[model samples]
Target: MLRIHFTDADLARTRIASAPDPLWEICASLHRMQSRQGRWAYADWYRGTRARLHDTGMVRTLRTLLLPLVPRAAYFPDFLTPPEAVDGLEAGVEAVLATGKERVRAEIGILHRTSGAPAWAPRLADPELRQDLVHALRRYHALAIAPHHDRVQARIDAERAARARAVLDGGTEALLAGLGPDLRWQHPVLHTRYPEDRDLYLNGRGLLLVPSYFCWGNPVTFGDTELDPVLIYSLRHEPHPSALPGDLGSGAPLAALLGRTRAAVLRTAATGATTGEIARAVGVSASSASQHAGALREAGLLVSRRHAAFVLHTLTPLGAALLRANAPCAEPR
Candidate 1:
């Protein structure tokens, strides 16, 4: 059984206090942006935001790749060109967020109806309005991120075709020789499925909460939290056969220092830290350690302040919990 643990308010509070960066801030800001922009370009915002949040890396990389595709005149801030060019994009994003909310309610409504719980009644009312909101968000993401997306899609398609060609060449011949008549192309041995709806909830980092009240439990009190195991395992798992360039398992002393450096930052818990101490404790050059600290700071996990020539960093509560959760476990309790 997959037992999902519920994070209580205290935990949330702790996370906020120790948070090292601005992830939530980004979410809140994005939500607010959608809300305000929804009044104008609803459609573009819906799709654009979704694209940006879901396939963030692709979206980001696309900016560079798509530069040629984008007209020289179209180069401007916020993915799309000027405001007049991206009409209804923002409103579309708002609608998608609304739609997502409705999906959650519908899922919860079904659970509630099945559970025969009276507390679920409040959530059932006007479920469509919320659902509409989520739909708006999806629409917004699609449109808002479209300018760069075309380039990304082309790049991905090209890469995929190249890989397929390589496999079909020498690779297929060797496989066919070994498998004889056992090989069957009709049944695909390799496949990939990207869950659009599920990815809608996760902000790439792989975490989101569905309100419990909408589900079988009290909508107000019983939401469920989902964590993507793939991302979690990738971020915090045993050593692998081949380590990444600067990954923790890479045997790079600088990479190893990050964990301890992060730990010291978290213990400070919003009080912040000095760059020199962070460097010394982490066993890295002050400049290199500062670079690491800057990343966490940028990621919204840590906040920094300038004291004379030195910068001090402190973990936000969220950063603390993340560090603790990612920390090496002692023993099975």
Candidate 2:
């Protein structure tokens, strides 16, 4: 088990990352490719990713470089998933490049001791070698991650909306408590499943809760406490979720009944999704999603309200009943 001790200030400061962290996703996605655990959840992504990697001739780079460095194990170097990744991939690669040589050596040494590293792993401290690794990461992301970014963003956006609701309905504690079945919030300490026993003290810096599309089974944190305290945990995935009604082909009867994207917009709003969330989830432009939502609101299928800069949409009774009649039985948890 891993325990995260938080102060009041930590609670005040604690928040979810507004956007996906690319480097962390890279690490998680690598683990997904390496392990069969929870493979069913990522069946589509797995198939697509494998084909992309093969077509791009990234097989050697993935095997000889990426997998060895980011083995699906208890420990991998923290520098690979730097906090700067929250900004974007390029910023993250820059952070990885900027890692101090001493820190890189120390982290690589830890990786080797905890979960065997390649013989060349120690040489990561060399700036030139780090550039090579960065290249591999970028290539892997392009092949595996960038293509599926919309789905990833939609899933993460849904999770963020749910968490945001939890915070508004209760407080920050509610957000933590409802993180997932794998995590438990016991007042000042948040406990999560881990391969080892450890404690993280977030004296006041708080914690960055990163909901990852690829992280599976457990929450991951930095090996070094001195780093920014962020917890990367698996986001719940429902195959063909209501939020992603667009996955059903455009010619499907449901699309014909409600006009494809409009129907997706409605389903996404079932959980009070924002206009932006609806746009991403249904693979439509924000203007399109807004127009669909406006039409639905006028038709009495959705209720919309302005909250801060976001307009939140929730399903009306008629809309819920319509969905219930058309929706399949809920997926088993």
Candidate 3:
């Protein structure tokens, strides 16, 4: 069990990541490829990414370079996922490149000790070798992570909406309490099932809750305590093939959402709304609002998630784009 001890100051400082971290998603998706644990949830992505890698002849790079470094294990270098990743992938890769050679060597050594690393792992300290690693990371991300950006962002947005509602209704503590079944919040300590036994003392720095689309099984945190505190966790999987990002033009056309109620439903979900909230905003009954939301969701325009006592609805990337074309005015009713 991993126990994260928090303080009063920690509660005041705790917050959710405003957006998904690309580097963490890269790491998590690599783990997904290594294990079949949650394969059913990502079956489409799994098959597609594999085929893309093979077609691009990046299969050797994934097997030889990427997997060794990011093995679905208890430890991988924390430097690979820096705080700079919050900015974007380029910034994160630059951070990885700029990591001190000595520190890189040390972390690689740790990886060898914890989980067997490649024989050449320590050579990553060489700047030339590091560049090769960075290049492969970029290629893998393009083939795997980039194509699914919309679905990943949609899932993260849904999670943010749910957590934001929790924070407003209860408090930061409530936000922590509802971080999926993998996490347990009991007073000042948050517990989780982990590969190893350990405890993390927040010590007033608080924690950043990063919702990752690919993270599976148990929640993950940096093995190094010196870095800023963060918990990268997976969201509840809802396999909506129509909603999953990929394939060209698999969705209904925007003209299909020309109906007044469905367009209103899409617009109201711009900032996320419950069924009742959507109904009230669009001047319709709850069941009517639900049916419209369902229609929009099927049209790949809205993503809904259940939080506490309500099902919150938010716009998917496709949904948002279509709403701009169909409902130029912000006011729903």
RMSD of each: 23.0, 10.2, 3.0
Tell me the TM-score of each prediction against the true structure: 0.23, 0.79, 0.94
Ranking by TM-score: 3, 2, 1
lDDT of 3: 0.88
TM-score-wise, the better of 1 and 2 is 2
Name the candidate that leads on lDDT: 3
lDDT of 3 by residue, 1-333 (tens): 999999999999998898889889989999998898888889889998999999999999999998999998889999899999899999999999999999998999999999988999898899899899889989988999999887788778888889989999999999999999999999989999999999999999999999998999899999998789999988898754453543327445545677777877787899899999999999999998998888777676788888878999998887776656655566768
lDDT of 2 by residue, 1-333 (tens): 999999999999999987788999999999998889888888878887899889989999999999998988889999999888888999999999999999999989998898898999889999999999999999999988887776677566667777898799879998998888899999999999999999999999999999998999999999899988999998866444232222433433333336877888888887778889999999989998898898876565666655446777877555666778888887899
Give the runs in model 1 whose Cα sits over 4 Å from its true position.
Answer: 1-266, 269-301, 306-312, 316-322, 325-333
The models' CA-based lDDT, in order, is 0.34, 0.84, 0.88
Give candidate 3's error at residue 306 in angstroms: 1.3
lDDT measured at residue 288 in model 2 versus the true structure, 0 to 100 = 84
TM-score of 2: 0.79
lDDT by residue for model 1 (1-333), tens: 112222232212211011111111122224333244222323333355555656645443233222212212201112111112112444433333343445545554544444332343234235554354334334433444334332222222322232233334535322212221222222212111211112112223322221110011011111233322111000011122212111233333334336665556445433445677777766778887777777675454555654335465655333544667777879988
